[model samples]
Target: MATRISSSFRGLILLSFFAYLCLCAHEAEETTETQHHHQISHTIPVISLIPSNACTSSAKGSERKASLEVIHKYGPCFQSKNYDEKVPNHLEILLQDQARVNSIHSRLSKEYSDNNKSRDSQVATLPATSGLPIGTGNYIVTVGLGTPKNDLKLIFDTGSDLTWTQCEPCARSCYSQVDPIFDPSKSTSYSKISCNSSECSQLISATGKPTTLLLYLRLRIRYKYGDGSFTIGDFSKDRLTITTEDVLDNFLFGCGQDNEGLFKGAAGLLGLGRNQISIVKQAAQKYGQFFSYCLPSTSDSKGHLTFGNGGVSSTVKFTALQTLSQSQSFYGLDLIGLSVGGTQLSIPKSAFSQEPSSIPARLSKVCLAFAGNRNETSIGIIGNTQQRELEVVYDVAGERIGFGKGGCR
Candidate 1:
């Protein structure tokens, strides 16, 4: 009986020992898993927040703004040459502009003659110039491109649709630029648009190229300015960095290989037109299709280009955008009359038609002209003149332009 009781007690002790071992092993396994999970969590990379994207979310579909500094090309701060040297340069630019204007008028006339019957009777007359700055003396904005970001100062052109810059491996030609040429090879995000793409097809059609050629060749874009300046290059997609921190991905732009003309020190051109390919259109999703700018009187004073409602204020005077069948790219304004210091001018309403080839006296120097010296011609320009005096708002949603005076000095 004593041996049986001792054997039973030994069996119970053995059972307890085995159960304790199993429990310890299970605990060890769970601890190892927890440590492994912690290791993985530390190894993973965290995504950094994008300012523009953050703003978009925080606004809850409300208005968001992105501000850009306006660079005055020939302002006193940017003048590198003497006044005498600038005179000849200005005259040369004016001549080129005159030629360009004549070419546009001739082309329009030919088009009218060819398709006048087929076209609508209400076909709007093309403007002499699209109120864009003609010469190198204009405004520019700094933009960063590529993965790591290569900064390029580009001209802000309201009349143009394609934004472009000189690129590397210039097998064809590239002019001397103030900044280093952008190298696509260095950018991981840079990509060439396939010929099969719709964008490429549209580009080919716009360039008057046969659609059949697209199947055999890559897409290329060519832009010719009124000043006789031209750029032809590949259509590509890349990242555009604005304000040094705000990044916009999959941005379409031209990579110029064969570039010529009066770019001055600018690396490229930023198209702000009402085209599908324009910068404003591309960023409309985030910016609400609204933009405004305040041009400073002096180059030393900093001006700004604001996306969304940054420049809007209570004092702005709104005007309806004129409907024109000729082109939707140009921002057309109806000029019923002109007032000078609260005095209305006696100029005929017809004189303000067709972008006014020449502004009458009293209205002199008030309208902005593409070419010619400001003194030789009274051609007024609202680009730098009015922009310098007021805050100009391009409200695409409202289909109107707003001018707020006393915003800039």
Candidate 2:
């Protein structure tokens, strides 16, 4: 009987020790308990095991500036009529993420030697019925569209340029969404663009194709994403509300009449890319073409998407930004150095790169949020999983990208 009690007490002690380690890993800089491992060559960075901002919610920079909460699509905050929809497993998420990355490589080939002259064959062509961007990942942000301002959940994407949503009178077909399909007829400010407008000409640069004309000479667009998804719809302008006070009049967007893709029940997507049609460019005058975001670390936790430079953090480290020659929408950076824990890894600077998840107890079930490239020439993509807790700033007017650690909202 005494032996049984001793064994049970030992089990409890082991469990308590594990719990303590987890708490320290997330909440504190160092653990009171020591760890010894045979395989590791150097000490693991305990400080980086779990970000300090996990599950924390706060607002910083610009009370009047436009900042919105970003939530995981699979998290508790997302509202959907279809509760029966199956949540994707971690493997499914990895596959979807890989597909999105592959599409990016297809759209922008890695070989930079040839002067980008007839690169259409190497590209993922978007016919009217052909494309919708990416896997949409796990995070989504809600936005107000139209004059009366109907709230729409959109996956804000830095790789895309056109902001679009599923619209009413689904002339052909529309996907199921978390919010009501935006009815343009009900909005007083909705207006369609003409096929001959200069804005329509810009569509060629944005989507890799010319705008098609509808029956009334109204412009229509067809966009194809790298992940084998596509949207076909009317090109129109309306009042876009970032916050109650921050609104953009005559905001251009795609009213997806025939939309098909894995948007994960989002109404649509908001483009934060660098082209003239992107929200970042359209709001250049008011927001100074400056925007920053910090993706949250966990599925249930929340981060933020902030526009304009008001009340900006002083700690952000700036790096030069270079546009990819293959696609103007994609951004490239020079990855000259890498540091893990407190020590810098001795990697070569000329290994030359063009482009760059969750928690578990025992840490056994944890999956890597990063995907490996097929070849050295394959274009590497930096997904939200890597951007989690990173304060990423896009200084378009200043022509740089900045990063700071431990950033969350």
Candidate 3:
């Protein structure tokens, strides 16, 4: 009995010692991680762009006009129209949302397909579209570029990576824009990249096309939209002014010499994709691979785009981001179960699977599968449907996305 008691005491002591060692190691690891995060935060700069005054100056007027137009064209229950039909005023605006969702789905599917295939295999061409619309949506931001600072109102797009605007010396092609076209020659900071440059190499890798020699030293890039709109221009770098006080120099963007299709009153696109050249990726040093936006439902209302960790709220419920091997530019989420009212739906987990080739069609119906309130205005489509209801948070650092109700409202 005495020997048995002594053995039990020894076992307890050994366990306690091991626990202490584990606790100490965990604490040390946490401390190191905290210090590394601190260092990163100090190094990267944060940029926040709000809905510009120009966008909100006549908010009521625009909202009323937009609402009236939507009701007249699509009525209470919006239905998809034929391509040949003249673009309705409100439908044109809403089409931006549709285009964005489609672009994201296409890119993600392509990325997934590429990853599953073996190396040295020819990549299949996926039908991808540029999300650019003829005019600006309610979520517009004023961006200043060049030496004297040419402020241009641009549509903020998370689905794309290349930021571009119509430029002067438009001998080739230029659309009638509300704002003045950007002239690279006027800006002392403007410089065209060469085909042999590393930046051009990266562009080639992304688009799978060689850089075209447009002018004497200008390297050209062709951007094709899913809607058949395409822009061909010089890929150059210049200073971009986000706010009155904050300016990002040598910002890489396309100087569109020849632009066509429906790019209405807006000047260009502000890309916030996951690529290295995207606004999010370029500012990763400051934002730490994270950004969030709250898209407003009304045309008159304003939405915000925040960089880094400032936008995440404590109330948001997060789900792990679905990581794909090929497409790092998209934020994919795994949706296990969906609920309607108090009862969970009987939908299969595989129904929401994003298997690249099967996702685009499955995603459109995933929302409908719940059979919730059919009268709900936001349904059928992915972008406007989900965004209008939930305050979607992209936690890039954590590799997760958080969805919460009433945050946007």
Candidate 4:
């Protein structure tokens, strides 16, 4: 009897040892895979915190308010500033708008002169189709008017409000940022809209300008340095090209002035917002109801952008966030919960202030109050000032949820 018992015990021990080995192997495999896909750029010094339920747990009425205070006292929002130096830099709203319009008009005027003044006959360049396939969520879309259409490299921006590109109009003497400008003459589909048209007047109204303003399109325009400094030229009825199985016809886009020459080479911007005829909305109006984006993990240092029905990826689970649609389309996630390590972050909805301003103005400059932390969440923008798409992806990448730059009420 004793000999039989010993044999059984040895067999059990061997089985347990094998199971343990298998578990360790599985864990190591997971770690290796994660390491292979990780992307790290400039190190973001972060404050380590133990999450708390007092802040993260859902509360009702007055109890919720008290829980938020406890969260602010202990949450990372208090210590986040110590780690991230890119605090939100708020700019006055009026000043920003003024800078945008001024930049556009000045550059457009120059491009007109340069193009029309060229005495020699020159063949316009044709646009080359970008061979990249649109990824599931994040992708870049280049738009232009003609053959060799000055291809504008545009990051489809959801977090930003104003969508413009660099232009030859302003290139007259400004710092050359990107590549050559988009020319309309070569495009067989290009058609210009009159300044007297109702559409022109409507565009002015949205920008806080008068109806008399002459609006033109350049290949690109950008909002930079806390101002609306854009480079634009004349508009055209161009059939925007896309790589999709569906028929895409009669797409409206602008031809940037190649004369001013200020662009750093980005083609132009494709605005995605709630406005009447912005890029994303226009596509959604014609295509499907859902539009998604995926930012390559900045940790990897490389990413792609996609648009239209063709741009959806299966890699990451998408958590649809709330969005504000006042001045433009802004993304948001329900402030249902926040966890810092093991601790939950407590924030009060009462502290949030929702106001109408440029999307960029809100995200990087607004100040909101946190419990123990006087001001929390200094949102900073990353990537090209021309890349509005990166902003949305950045916001989504971090533990920080919601969109817009502002202070708690």
> Please, what are the lDDT tens digits per residue for candidate 3 over residues 4-98?
11100000000000001000000011111111000000111111112122222222222221111111111212122321223345456446544
Ordered list by TM-score, greatest first: 2, 1, 3, 4
Top candidate, metric lDDT: 2
Considering only N, C-alpha and C atoms within 3 Å, which residue pairs clash in candidate 3? 44-285, 44-286, 45-286, 129-226, 130-225, 130-226, 134-262, 134-263, 134-264
- Give me the overall lDDT of model 3: 0.49
Q: Better model by TM-score, 1 or 4?
A: 1
- Candidate 1: 10-residue stretch with minimal lDDT: 9-18
Per-prediction TM-score: 0.66, 0.74, 0.62, 0.43
lDDT of each: 0.52, 0.60, 0.49, 0.30
Select the stronger candidate by TM-score from 1 and 3. Answer: 1
Which candidate comes out best when scored by TM-score? 2
Candidate 2: C-alpha lDDT? 0.60
lDDT of 1 at 320: 60
Q: How much is the lDDT of residue 389 in candidate 4?
A: 18
Candidate 4, residue 66: how far the Cα is off, in Å: 48
TM-score for candidate 4, residues paired by index: 0.43
The parts of candidate 3 lying over 4 Å away from their true place are 1-138, 210-217, 348-381, 405-409
User: Which scores higher on TM-score, 3 or 4?
Assistant: 3
Evaluate residue 401 in candidate 4 and report its C-alpha lDDT on the 0 to 100 scale: 22
Off by over 4 Å in 2: 1-56, 61-64, 81-84, 110-135, 208-216, 226-228, 340-371
